[model samples]
Target: MLPLWQLTVAEAAAAMDRGDMSAVDLCEAYLARIGALNDGLGAFLTVSADLARIQAAQADARRAAGERGPLLGIPYALKDLFVTAGLRTTAGSRMLADYVPPYDATVYRRLQVAGAVLLGKLNMDEFAMGSSNEFSAYGAVRNPWDRERVAGGSSGGSAAAVAAGLCAFSLGTDTGGSIRLPASFCGVTGFKPSYGRVSRYGMVAFASSLDQAGTLTRTARDAALVMGAIAGQDPLDATSADKVVEGYAAGLSGRLDGLRVGLAIPEAGDAEQAQLLTDARRILEAAGATVEDVRATADEALIVPTYVVLVTAEASANLARYDGIRYGHHVPGDDLAAMLGAGRGQGFGAEVRRRILMGTYVLASGYQDAYYGQACRVRELVRRRLEATLSPEGGLDLIVGPTTAGPAFPLGAKLTDPVAMYRNDIYTIPANLAGLPAISVPAGFSAGPAGPLPLGLQIVGRRWAEATVLRAADAFQARDDSWRRRPVMATSAASA
Candidate 1:
């Protein structure tokens, strides 16, 4: 039998419903696992043991009182980007290291209302800036598959936590592939909803237009369950869409009959990743879906540069508020302006500073049209092309591709070369740019120098088509059980 800590959110909820285990039992098991593994993994920045216990107790009481919820009593954690009222909400930077939010993010509040237990905050890239977890002020998050490799980021810790069974699920934000990249590296299920599908009122902003709240879970079904709980329009977030939330969990058929799936052939990619894409096509075809090859587009190359420009500009505007006055780390200086510069210089990590500087330059009056404005135009073109390809009248039902160019690389491999590091997000950034729903499902494993590392297959759907994406992912996962294979580190942690 699988240990409680290893169970998926859906599995644990069923177990609790069957009276096979109590909420408290589930919580304690996870806490024990986190305690044993977090020191080595650096997955969690804060483990709210006392608060988790209280939430677990409350969940138990709710279950006893005949109040049933899909997420009731299930343990989860958040990327430190989400502001939790009393819990420390560090955006993986010293700037907000000591800052405690006075209000809860709408997503977290919704999960709490669903009776889920919060274990604490997970680590992330500073201000959600970097492609790898290396930029975190708390120290880099080590991949569970191979300790020396990266877990992927800026949501690396969220993915690592779920992969290591520290939590049944975790909330993460995806701004240019943060959630999906890490999920691919860590071999977990990651789902980034269509922009505005979930409220981002209390989430730390990286890029206002691109950043979206998402989930990292053990399986696609688990993601559906969590999404159903937290996804909806919120008054707090004006950008949140007012569309009716669908019954995502109930809609997962795990059968892709008649679904038109497109295999996005990446441009002369690594051989292993190309094979993974071919393998994914076979699985979908075997499961009764029609598959076709999609030739790479010119706009594909524009994703990274366009994303960098737009996000950095937004980031510059958003981060300007953190100038030693309102909250976060403060450094006293001779005057107000000097103090602001001193505080930001001391508080932000190197990656954050770099992006801020780039953003400021791109948004400057002289370069705005040449860079930022042009990037926005390219972004719109990319979105239009993707929309046409996924349109029901003339195109495919879904698009599939390798989540990353390759598996998790060595920890310091791309640190010095920021371009190489940014390239890591190449395949996963399109959906974010287009404001579409996408998921990264563990497809298979690739042998690494240290050991076997997981590779992911990405499934993308039209805007607001999360149900379709989840169905395809669930069907693929159901057909291929490769996702069931756990890392050796995870196995050792479960036993310990």
Candidate 2:
């Protein structure tokens, strides 16, 4: 059996059910792992050890009472953006560094009901603005594979935590590519459901339309199990879909016969990436699935620009509530304008402030029509184009491609180049723009100077077809073991 902390969500759950370990035992194992590894990973912003123990005890009690919940006794963490009643929720920003939510996020509430233990809060980019996670006010989350490389943005800590075995899995929010990018870099499975499939209530709003809650886990099956707990209609969130949730894990029939996987654009990066694609194709084809190139007519170049304009405009509105006059980091001044200005200037990090300014500019009177409006139109076009491409009539079951241009880059390599950093998300932004369900599974790895850096193959399905996405990823993972690779940090922590 694997170490308690290193077990996947499903494995740990089954272990506890077999009486091999108790909920408290599992929780303690994860807490100990986090204690040993979090300092170097920067994956967790707050370790709720006491809360975890309490929850673990409760889960044990429930299990003793014969409540057979899938997540019962399993330990996991949330990106700091998720609100936890009575727990500090920082959103990786000074603006809410000391803020404790009075209510729990809908997703967190559901997971709690499922009997999952809350290990802690994971770090993220402040206000979910950056692509490399360096904009995290708390600090950058280092790649577990290579300590000097980034773990990808926004959900960096979520992926890093899972990769380092700090937690079994972590919840992350993806606006553009936050969850998938980090998952790809960290060599974990990242699953982003179709927009509105999962409730966003109680989460710190980034770009409301684009923001979707997802998971980072060691395997696609773990992601499926977690999604089962978190995905459903929410009365609190009007945007949440009213569709019924499928038995995601059960949907993994392991039958890929006649499946049509489309090769999406941006081509491949290096020979390593190209080889990864070729291997992925071979694997899919060997499974009785057909892999073919998809000729997309929409200008892929507009995806990033359109996403930036729309999300920034939404961010400008969402973050306006953080004015110090209410709550947050306050800076006093003689006048109202000065007070608001000073407080925001000091509260938000550079990236957040820059985004706010750019968002504000786009939404301004005359510029609104030219930038934000056009972006919205383009977003609609992207949605229609993608939907059309994935329609049953289009003969494409899923879209497949590399999640990132390459493996994780060294930290600070693209910090000064926002364009390059933004481009890193080029392969991923289209999904969020089109509100499709996407999963990034560990494709393989490329040798870097420091260690083996992972690559990812993304599977994007029709909107609200998270079941298909998970099932396909599950099939691929069953055929390969790349998803099982652990980084040096995790291995060292296990030995320790």
Candidate 3:
């Protein structure tokens, strides 16, 4: 059997059920892994050992009482922005570094009800603002595969922690590919459900329209288990779907029979990446699915710009509530304006401030129509284009492509140029814009300057089609086990 630290959520639950291991045992193994790797990797901003032990004990008690569920006794961590009652929920910014929510986020509450243990809060970009984890006020999340490279952004810690065996699985938010991008870099399974598939209540807002709760796990089955636990309607979030949540794990039959897959070769322009997608096409075909290359009618290049304009505009408004009076870092000043300015100026990181300024300018009077308005119109076009192609009558059941343009880059490689950094998400931003379900599965390894870096294959489906998306990914995993690979550094660190 694999070590408890290396067990996937599914494996851990099975082990616990058979009495081979308990939730406490799983918790301790992960805690030890985090203790050994977190300082260098920066995967966790906070480690709640006491809370974890308490939860693990409760989970064991429930299991003893004959409560059987897939997630019961599973240990998982949450992104810092997912507010936890009495636990510091910093959105990776000094502004909220000390703030503790009075209530837990809907997703966290759901996971708790399933008897899952909380490992702690993972680090992220301040206010979930940047493509690279470098924008984090805490510190960049170093890729476990190579400490010198980034683990990817804003959910970098969540992905890193899962890949490094620090947790069974970790919840993250996907706003402009935060979860997918990081999962790709860290070599884990990242699943972003359709918009509104999961409640957003209590999740620190960052482009609320685009922000959706998701998870990073060792495999698609693990992601399915977590999704089944967390995906449901919530009275707290009106945006949450009122529809019934499907049994996600049960849908993973490891077959994609009668499904039509569209391959976006243009998006996978690089020879290596294109070959990976081509291989994926063949794999999907062999799995009882018809695969064919499909070109995008809409210009794919406009995806990033449209996403930036809209998300930044939304972020500018969402972040305005952090004034000193509203419970955040306070800076005293002689006048109200000065006090507010000082508080916000010092509280926000450079990236957050930059985005706020950009958003504010675009939303300014007389410029709204020229920028924000035009961007919204363009966004509608992009969404329509995607919806039309992925609709039931639209010939395609899923779209396959590279999750990112390439593998993880060296830390701070594109930090000086935010545009360059933003472009890294070019392949991923489209799904967010269209409010679709997408999964980034570790597809293959790319030979890098240091060692073999992981590349991810993205499978996107129509909005509210998470089951289909997850099924496709599971089928792919059945053929290729790349998602099961862990970084070498993590192995050595855990052994030490």
Candidate 4:
């Protein structure tokens, strides 16, 4: 039998429903695992052990009354970026280390209603700025497969926690590849729903326009389960789309017959990405999908520049609230100006400060039209190109590609170079730019001292098409056995 902590939420729910296990017992097992592993992994900023037990007890009561939802009795963690009522939502920033929100995010409240047991808050890049988790003020999150390498970022802690069985699943946010990249590195499933599909009401702003809350889980089916619960329109967020959410779990068994899968490679992807894409294509073909090599129409290059301008412009406006007088870090002193200046300067990490500076510069009076304006027009054009390509009349069910350029690199390797680090997100960033639904599933691996690191396949669907994306990911996952297995780290072999 697989370790209880390693079991997917579906399996755990079924077990609980069968009376084979108690919610309290399962919760304790994961709590113990987090206690044992988190010191080395640095996956969580805070673990809510007391609140978890109480929630578990409540779940047990609900089960006794014969009530259950997909996530009932399942222990999960939040990417510290999501506010949890009364729980410290640091967003991995020293600026908000002791700051606890008075209320929960819409998604958090929904998950609670679905009966999920909240374990704690996972670590992340401060303000979700960096591509690597090293930007976290707390510490970097280590990959479970190879401790020396990163687990990808800003949701690295969420992915690492799920990979190491510290939590059965985790909530992560992706502004630009944060969810998918980490899921690729950690060997799990991560899904970013269509913008406005999942409410962003209480998620701390990184770049409000681009930020999206998603799930990192052991399986695509588990992702479907989680997304089904939390996805909906919210009165709190005006941007929340009022679209009807389908049964994402039910879509897991969707047929692949007559499905058109687009392979977005201009001159073919790089060797590593090509191999991952090739493997993914074969899986799709075996599942009855028609794989076609689609041309990029010269508009693909605009995705990054357009996304950066839009996101940074929003970041500049959204982050103005952190001026020491509001709910963030404040230096104690009689002079208000000195306190605000020192607090902000000392609180934000290098990457966050860099982004703020860049945002301020671009939004300045003279450059707004030249930089931010042109970017928005280009964004509309890119959006048009994507919609035209993925139209039902144009014969496309989903777009498939590599989740990242490669697997996770060493911890400090990409820190010195921001542009180089950002390149790691090339494949995954495009989906975020379009505000489309996307998922990453383990496609293969790369050899390493710990055996090999994970590779992932990304599936992109049209707006509010999470059900289709989940179905495709589930089919791909079902066709592969490699993702079912995990590397065994020998405790006897001590690290130098």
Q: Mind giving the per-residue lDDT tens digits that candidate 3 earns over 388-411?
A: 889887888899988888889998
Cand. 3 TM to true fold: 0.98
- State model 3's lDDT: 0.89
Task: Write down the TM-score of every candidate.
Answer: 0.98, 0.98, 0.98, 0.96
Model 3 Cα RMSD, 1 decimal = 1.3
TM-score of 2: 0.98
Query: How displaced is residue 407 in candidate 2, in Å?
Result: 0.5
Q: Look at candidate 4 and tell me the lDDT of residue 451.
A: 69
User: In what order do the candidates fall by lDDT, top score first?
Assistant: 1, 3, 2, 4
**3 against 4, candidate with superior lDDT:** 3
Clashing pairs in 1: none
What tens digits encode model 2's per-residue C-alpha lDDT throughout 1-496? 7777778888888888899999998888887788788888899999999999999999999999988977998999999999999999999999998999999999999999998999999989998888788998889999989889999988999999999888888999999999999999999999999999999999999899899999999998999899999999999999999999999998987768878889764543578767877888888887778889875322447988888888889999999999997799999788999899899999999988888888999999999999999998988988888888898988888998889888999999998877777778888898998999999999999889987999998999999889888988998998989998888774464534
Residue 421 alpha-carbon offset, candidate 3, angstroms: 1.3
**Candidate 1 vs. true structure, TM-score:** 0.98
lDDT of the candidates, in the order given? 0.90, 0.89, 0.89, 0.85
Question: Model 4, 1-496: lDDT tens per residue?
Answer: 5568867899999999988898898899888888777888999889899999999999999999989777998999999998987898898988887898999999999989999999999999888877779999999999889999998899999999988888889999999889999998999899999888999999999887778999999898999899888999999999999999898898777458788999876464678777777777888998888999887432336766676677777876877778767778888889988988789888887888877888888889999999888887887787777888887877788888878767788889988987787667777777777789999999888887666889888889988889889889889888886568664543312210
lDDT of 3 at 321: 95
Off by over 4 Å in 2: 296-300, 490-496
